[model samples]
Target: MSDDNGLPGAQTRRALLAGAGAVGAAVVLAACGGDEDPAGPGSAAPTAPDGSGEPGAADVVVRAADVPVGGGVILASKGVVVTQPTAGVFKGFSPICTHQRCPVSAVDGGTINCTCHNSRFSIEDGSVRSGPATQPLPAKEIVVDGDRISLA
Candidate 1:
């Protein structure tokens, strides 16, 4: 009654479905990867390198003043967290937690926090600060023009 996978009744519909479910779960976990947070601390998100080709007003996400130094402001509607690690320097990152894709709830104590699993990412670079998360938040590109911060 065993099939190639060596499970009893493996030719039955129930057995096939159970095997498919296990394969699907394994694929999901493999995509999530391991404990290494490849984006090391202080690895800044990419920014516009020059003043050319700036995003217009409609792309603007916030005013530079709104994101405080050493902290961040999460724009839920835009799905980004804009952080000012130091004066006049801002970085943008996805607000979605790298662990489980939950929206990060707050930016405080120098990290972007996800209340779901208590994961935290560095406000400066989106690197994991404390985790159940092993990945840094994916970087989001932004342009800073005078006081306007816009998506890029």
Candidate 2:
């Protein structure tokens, strides 16, 4: 009773529809991801190179006094973690973990920790301090203007 195509008309039609649905879903996923977090669902609003929210915008991340020497602060809105590795040096990196694109949970004990998979990255250079991630965190430049901090 089957046609020369080796399947009934309804079965062949159903198979084609299933394949099309899968392709459509993949396209939808690809369109949503552009840059910043390539494979992530998305990230916070774009953080400008100067860390300003927008043009003519000068965003002050935090007071210099707020960041502890040898420690850092997580500016969620800016999607950056600023670390003061030494007495007066500040470093910035994307908080998204390279392990699985999870937002880094915290910087503690001199490492950035991701709660999702227990991956760790050094606070000093964003190098992987633990496994499940081989690539270091992506660095972002910032400038310390006296007591103010902004993307550079």
Clashes of each: 0, 0
Q: How far off is residue 98 in model 2, in Å?
A: 0.5
Give the clash total for candidate 2: 0
The worst-scoring run of ten residues by lDDT in candidate 1 lies at 46-55
Weakest 10 consecutive residues, lDDT, candidate 2? Answer: 48-57
Q: Per-residue lDDT tens digits of candidate 2, residues 1-152?
A: 55435744877788899999999999999888755565456656666555657642456676677788878888878889999888888889998999789898888888888899999888899999897988999997888888778777
* lDDT value, residue 56 of candidate 1: 68
| lDDT per residue as tens, model 1, 50-109 | 333453655678889889999989998987899998899999999999899999999998
Off by over 4 Å in 2: 1-57
Task: Name the lDDT value of residue 71 in candidate 2.
Answer: 82
Candidate closest to the true structure, highest lDDT:
1
List TM-score per model, in order: 0.63, 0.61
Q: What lDDT does candidate 2 reach at residue 96?
A: 93
lDDT of each: 0.87, 0.82
Alpha carbon deviation, residue 14, candidate 2 (Å): 45
Query: How well does candidate 2 match the true structure, expressed as C-alpha RMSD?
Result: 10.4
